[model samples]
Target: MGKPVACLAVAIMILFLYYVIDVISHASGNRYKEGDPIPLYANKVAPFHNPSETYPYFDLPFCSPAHVEEKKEALGVVLNGDLLVVAPLKLDFLVDREPESICRKRLTKEEVARFRKAVLKDYFFTMYYDELPIWGFLGKFDAEGIDDSIVTSVYLFKHIHFEILYNKDRIIDVIIQGDLQNALLDVTDNKEVEVDFSYSVKWIQTDIPYEKRLEKYSQSSSLLHNMEAHWFSIINSCVTVLLLTGFLATILMRVLKNDFVNFTHDEEAVDEQEVSGWKNIHGDVFRYPRCKSLLAAAIGTGTQLFTLSIFIFMLALVGVFYQYNRGSLITALVLIYAFTSGIAGYSSASFYHMLEGKNWARNLIFTGSLFSAPLFLTFFFLNTVALAYNSTAALPSGTVVVIFLIWTLLTTPVLVLGGIAGKNSRPEFQAPCRTTNHPRQIPQLPWYRTTLPQMAMAGFFPFSAIYVELYYIFASVWDHKIYNIYSILFIVFIILLIVTAFITVALTYFQLAAEDHEWWWRSFLCGGSTGLFIYGYCWYYYGATSDMSGFLQTTFFFGYMACICYGLFLMLGAVGFRAALIFVRHIYRSIKCE
Candidate 1:
């Protein structure tokens, strides 16, 4: 026991040190002097419409350095589909360069065909200098003419103009533009043609501080245009929450109080009248739910996900996961989720024990895999698709091994320790009323009062509260838009959870009042139904709002969205069950029973 404990401690310390060193290595304090070598890296190129399907920049017939070299990046960057390689162009800090030819190449039929196809699909290329990125279109297709006469033109940009902004020794911004007017090459035919790749660089002094350089990208014109709409959606959700809260408060205080008064009448009066409603089911309200192990595991996973979301939002709000850091958010997510596995184990073990479950080992194992198993299968399928397409989104062998080791060495041990502690300290299940030897018969109800309709009603309000926000989130993930509004997102997240809890509690009360004793699973499904609506909304957004269209992008989008919705379902369902449990215990404990 002592040796095992020591090993666990060593493993945790090692993981913590690894992340700390990684963060320190990414410190943004790069300083350069005049005439210093400024290396440029060419990243991936992809169709503007299908952002997920990206190939290496060198995949096209672009000019390359004699000895090709790739830039090492963080795990997050690689996962985000970035493949940065050293470009052939020469650049120097604070030095202006006149237009100069990079290389001359005679285009073959195959090369010309590839370029034309890229232009027709509207491909874009990304480059980076000193950790700052810039983008430009490869080429364009245009058709225009006077009335009734149309002339089609297909051309590629042969020249690039780079405008870099700097403040003293720090680089503020880097902008790249394709010189379409001056260096357009006609690519309408398969004839052999000589192409000259030329570029010009200009350095401009700017007063913007290095700390504030990322604001320009975060505050894009598109974001500004939608800012008012975003705020309006937030306001509308707030109103919905307020209305739900008021209705819940009235039901809890007024209707429940009257029920309590009638149940507390004199013994003679109580004998004369029939006792129905929730009071009649006091003996069965706390019956152990079906699939007890699964329920415990789901609640535990939900608790971990809820905690993870709060931590991420707080970190993003405080600028730890800043906009300039390309892969920081995803990196944080992976590390945090690994560390939070212990919470899942603890929650699951305690709940399982409370439910009188005897298979402790099986319960613990199920808790650990409740969320990750499906996620791993999904990623495995997607990774295979990405590899077949030769896309940079595929995870490398080393990254996969490292992640596996982290889960095995760190996450598993912590989870085991937590489960042991939870089992040892598990609280006894306490119900306000004693259970009878047999279950009571349940009365039939109307269609609206049934579980399905109740779930639909309970789910729609929560989904409506966040569908508007989902648009922005989808835009950020599928499109190339950067999302920096963490504070607003945090507010909406709180609203979503609150609305879910209130509606679930109200629905549970109604079900119980109608003499339904099986509120355990129904309460959870009521809240989890919101995930269905959220997934449906993803389908609508993909078809209507987004330009993304391709097999790879479609699979990646829906696959990941499904994972996200499942996590939300678990989190929301756990919240609903907890709320209903509290309401039941309070009302039962207050009853005037003999």
Candidate 2:
């Protein structure tokens, strides 16, 4: 007991230390004074379109420059005409006198004519600011007297200022603005079109302190000021789940206790009562599910995802990745998923073996490639479209090759090793109730107790628990808002898990009570149906909340959404199965069987 107490104390101290370190990390080295060169990175260029021509009707062609170069440590991209360049500025308070380089590409007379025609054909410039595209041509362009021979020069302007108060660290604010200046060249046109870039910095000391400045920088915009509402929803959902859990515990536990006591009485009482309901189908409860190999593979893949999600969230909580660190999250996900392939292989093989499944090779292969194949295909298609549009969002060929190598060299080998280990391990599918040679026939269930209704009921609770938080996540992803409340997200994640487990157990009990011995697939689908709700929510979000309008954006949204939904299906299915497995084993073990 003392040893256990000591271990618990040590664990508590370690956790406290971790939190302290996390706070210190955020507070330290975050100061930026005046006269610092702020780093600006370009994302992509897209054509601007009117609201009427946004979605299905929008057919504007956007492109990244054919060539990019760095001169004197300054990056530049060649632009022939008006184009929207997305250069996101970090919230670093600093100013540099050095101007960014922008190379102007001179177009021939014929090329200029083509460019003018393209511009007239609904091709306008736009830029991304605060994650939303600002139409550059809205009121900034002067189109009168513009023709083929007119020279267009683009100007990039960056302004940075510090808001400081006494005894407080200064807060930095940055604004990036661009303007297009056009002039016609005459005979003896010795004047060359030159691109001008300028930056200015200013400091203002006020009563606002550093903490307030940081808060201002990290605070959610008006559009995302639903944090309180989200918390309310979460609390409401938690109360509902708690009530359900209490009801379930009261009814199931009390009834099961009485049943166990009565059934374990004298032999005469036991014979008189006999077995009924769930006990009647005990033999079939643990029977191998049909298509056991497929189920096993899914479970394996889900386990891998579960492990990956935990680590990712922990890393996020620790501030290893942030919204400003572009692509860091994706890179971490890819590497973590690759490294966790072993868990998938091991889980799939072990579960398949437990189910007495043959086709070990097929099961192993399916486990390894089930999730990865669709992910790769979706990414490939999206990247292909991006490349065709010459968008910088497209992954480079070398990066793609590296990902392939990681999958092939590291992921695949680890999976094979894990599969071997799982196969060699002892089979441990022992059930509390002995399964007979013949499977029991499942009885028909009522409408409310049917598979579909139970799944809908089971899934609704978990989805409800997270839908509010889900909206914020969607805003952060699609709207480009910085989500800094990792602690809240982590809490909500825990709540979601609890709700999923409780709801799954309650639903599984009802199915078993209905004499539906075929609970394996039903149990899996019951929880996983949350993904359907999530997909439906996605549809609603696209049509209602999001302002994104383009064929490429639409395709990218739905295409990647499919992968996300599929992953949720696997994850929730595994969660339901594990929970139901434990519940079933507990109930069955308490029964007095002759």
The numbered model that scores best in lDDT is: 1
Candidate 2 RMSD to the real structure? 8.5
User: What TM-score does each of the candidates earn?
Assistant: 0.94, 0.74
Which runs in model 1 stand beyond 4 Å of their true positions? 1-28, 144-151
Which residue ranges in model 2 land beyond 4 Å of their true spot?
1-41, 46-67, 70-173, 177-216, 223-226, 270-274
Report backbone clashes per prediction. 0, 0
Q: Report every candidate's CA lDDT.
A: 0.84, 0.62
**lDDT of model 1, residue 258:** 90
Taking all chains together, the TM-score of candidate 2 against the true structure is: 0.74
